[model samples]
Target chain A: MGVIFLHTLNRMRGTMLGWGLSLAGVAILFMTFFEDIATQADTLKRLMQSYPPEVLALFGAIQDLSTPQGFLGMYFFSSMPLILGIFAVLAGSGLLLQDEEEGVLDLLLAHPIDRAQLFLGRLLGMMVVTAGILAIAFAGIALSTQWAGIDTAIVELAKSFITLYVQLFFLSAFSLMLSLLMPGRSTAAMTSGLLLFVAYFINSLSSEVESLRQAARFTPMHYYQGAQAIGEPLDWGSLLGLLGLGLVFLAVAWWRWRARDIRITGEGAWSWRGLLVRSRGSSA
Target chain B: MRSIEGNAKTLDDPMQIPAIEIKGLTKSYGRVQALRGVDLEVRQVEIFGFLGPNGAGKTTAIRCMLDLIRPDGGELRVLGMDPRRQSVEVRERTGYLPGELSLYPNLTARGMLRLLNSLRRHRADPATIESLAERLALDLDTPIKNLSKGNKQKAGLLQALMHRPELLILDEPTLGLDPLMQKEVLQILREARAAGTTVFFSSHNISEVEEVADRVGIIRKGRVVEVLEPESLWDRSLRRVRVRFRKAVDPQRVAEAPGVTLLDGSDGTSVVLQVTGEMGGLIRVLAQLPVRDLETERPTLEEIFLALYRNDEED
Candidate 1:
């Protein structure tokens, strides 16, 4: 665990700091306009109604513009998924592939650690870093809301933040598992990043395209559902589904990782266990 | 085979447990075979050299011992424990240095060592690390990126040696080092073996392997083709002999000489023969003629290595 976290943090601290600070910066930048927007809430709401439902859905359809939750839900929550999803994809692919690609995995593996333990350690380290970034975002938004003199429901805000985090957690894990199946780092990162964008688009356009509503169910972004957390109870079913999917992805990642041969120049031949596991109808 | 200079006990103890043992180990890539039934055994406290050219599966065999890569078929034991089933136990007792040493660019040498040391089942001694750093003339405070390639390699060596495990598996251990440092590293390996630490190191340089290895396992095309002592190879040294007869003698008589193979370009002026053993037969044949000047040249290590392969091919 120490080796995994130390090595992961050594490699990833800069990326984490950059993403976390910039995300919080973006959230803070959006919040500065909150006070000015609150004054023209009625007019802004009418303007939003004039746009197509697709645009409204993309922005997480706001019912009451005067409230802080509605204002944040419209801009911040709507766009945060894309930012968080991109970070997740990068982190997921980089964590597993960095050592091998950089020619460091063999040296690290020379230590007294098993494949399963190493996999768990790296996965946990990525999880902790992702959580830390979202925690900062949550704090930044909360402070910005308070400074803007809006009385948002604290419980609702916390629940929304938790739900948003869970969605990204699952998305990043699924991407990580997807990366395990890829041959190269850049290919994995690009593939997972493209998947994130596609999912975001499908989830957003589901409102306008009736046929896509069913399709959105498969997109990871569909489970975020943070826009409505303040008005009603949090979606436990969707949250559980996301959690379940995250576990499945992680398990698959482990299943494949346990048997994969790592190399410095490039990938090695597929292991016998990898083939055996695949033939037994496990993760590919 | 024990070293010519090794302690008598290692050679005397027929019941001694082998430090590493692999029987008919086999591994293959999708279409390209990487290892083809490799069989080798290195006894405790012996310095075993794994010699092969590039892409000859030396690194693959080392990786299998560490459980970093699984073998397709074989029974492999390190310290009498199965590498696949008791990997952690095997790893805890064995220290490995990869052929390509890559350290974290951001971490200081000390930081990297400390992190790696933290993973040891029996924690590595910090004093051991310091002593090694001092001996190697390495800066522990410098970030890995700031260190030169040779400096980084020194740090890599320090991490593997600091723990003082029962067995050390090093792949191309002296790569990317200056000649002076290379000699010092070999001395360190020799000292480790003298201290009863089993050292299993690999290299393509025949002289380096001959300098320190107790027994050498020659690998070619993913198989251990031969295992022999350096002294034996030295004894069988193929010599190129030149002879000039004062008077014209029968070329057939010199060409068909025992323990000698007449090389091309052997004309009346000078006859060149590749002699593998004692020069008694060649000397007797040359004595019969009016010999003027005689010359003998020994084959280089590389030539001898190639000769071994060439002999194997013919067989």
Candidate 2:
């Protein structure tokens, strides 16, 4: 477990560097708006003068971008979760699925570790690294706000960052589940991409599409985006729902992975037991 | 054809139980059968050679025994433990060099060894590993991606041997090595055996197996066709004799000689004989040939392996 976690952490170092740069860029952009809210507010109003409320709502759905708290919400809450959420999915899928693709899983499984321990160890490590990335982004946002002389509740801002990072936990689980179900890395990557895009579309279109509004309840993003624990009372119900979805996806992924016949370089022939098991169940 | 269970003297008789035992092991990918009722055994402390052509299920059997892949139907025990149920224990005592020597590309040779050492959770003396590396002429500071195939193989050998496990399971261990390095690996295996380590390895190289293996198992179409001691095998299989007569010899007379399967007779001066059972009868015939030159050759391991595979193909 320690070996797997260390390796996962090592892999995330590169991705974390990218996240740091992005957060730094966003923080610089937020710094530009700190000096004068009235002028910025006027510019935003003028910018939205010709656009419809739906379009402005897409742009302004979170909070007024005039105050530090609102600006933090716009910069960190509105963008970081989505950016880091995708990053988490891509990273998590590659972590375990690449072993299968490379066929190293065979050599690894020959060792003493159990399947459950390996899964949980890798998942925990990935979660820790992801949490670390979000924390760095949070630190970047806080410093930028303070340097700009903006007054905001640190506790409230911290809560919002936590909510955003928690969204990534759900995405990592969902992407990992997709990785185990697909046979090849390319197929797994495409499936994770489709899941992420579909989830995003579902969350965005929920308000516009009458039929999808209630259907969005099944999507994790709906709960994560709606949790909005900052600048408001914490929504325990949505938080619990997101947590439950994450656990369920992880369980399904574990079940799928336990039985996977990992081939190195994808060169080995198929196993008949897999066919027997599939025949006993659904085709999938 | 020998039942590992029926051979119960394994408990009391040191030679009765093989160090490695596999029975009725069957595996398939979709419609392709990788192994079908494959059974094999290796006596304790003996150098057992598994010889097979590509796609002949040698790797599959090894993987199953290592518990890397769960077999569909089989019972496997290595060093008296079920590999699937006790993989960690098996791995702890077994040194394995995979067919493909792939390590973390970003890690240097030393880093790769350190990582494996950490995973094995054993105290691998740096000095010992360094000496092995130096002896193999492998560079320790170079990243694995930058190393040539031979160097990568050397790195893998270091990882497998540094821990000094009791059993060495090497798959094509000499791949990418210079002839000298190949000889070095063979000597290392011999040294390990002398130290009481049971060595189970697979190879396509016939001479290497003939040089080291105490017993050889030939597999074809995922089944063991023959397992025999080299001396005994050479004794049983057919022999070749080339006789150049001083003058023209009678072909019919030579054909009537016992145990001589006539291969060819040209110009009445030279003759080839496939001696099936013994050289006793052929030697008797050659005494009367007034031979100018004579040579006798035994069937090589290569021929035996090819014959086994070709027979499988015919079947």
Q: What is the TM-score of chain B in candidate 1?
A: 0.79
Over B5-30, each residue of candidate 2 has an lDDT whose tens digit, in order, gives: 11111234456656799888999876
Best by lDDT: 1
**Alpha-carbon runs more than 4 Å astray in model 2:** A36-38, A52-62, A265-284, B1-17, B232-306, B309-314
Correct interface contacts retained, every candidate: 0.84, 0.31
List the DockQ of the predictions in order: 0.65, 0.34
The candidate scoring highest on DockQ is: 1
TM-score of each: 0.87, 0.84
**Worst ten in a row by lDDT for model 1 chain A:** A265-274
Give the residue spans of candidate 1 off by over 4 A.
A49-57, A267-284, B1-15, B237-306, B311-315
Candidate 2 C-alpha lDDT tens digits along A78-157 = 55555676787787687687766665565565445667767877888888878777777777767776777677667877
Write down the worst ten-residue block by lDDT for model 2 chain B.
B1-10
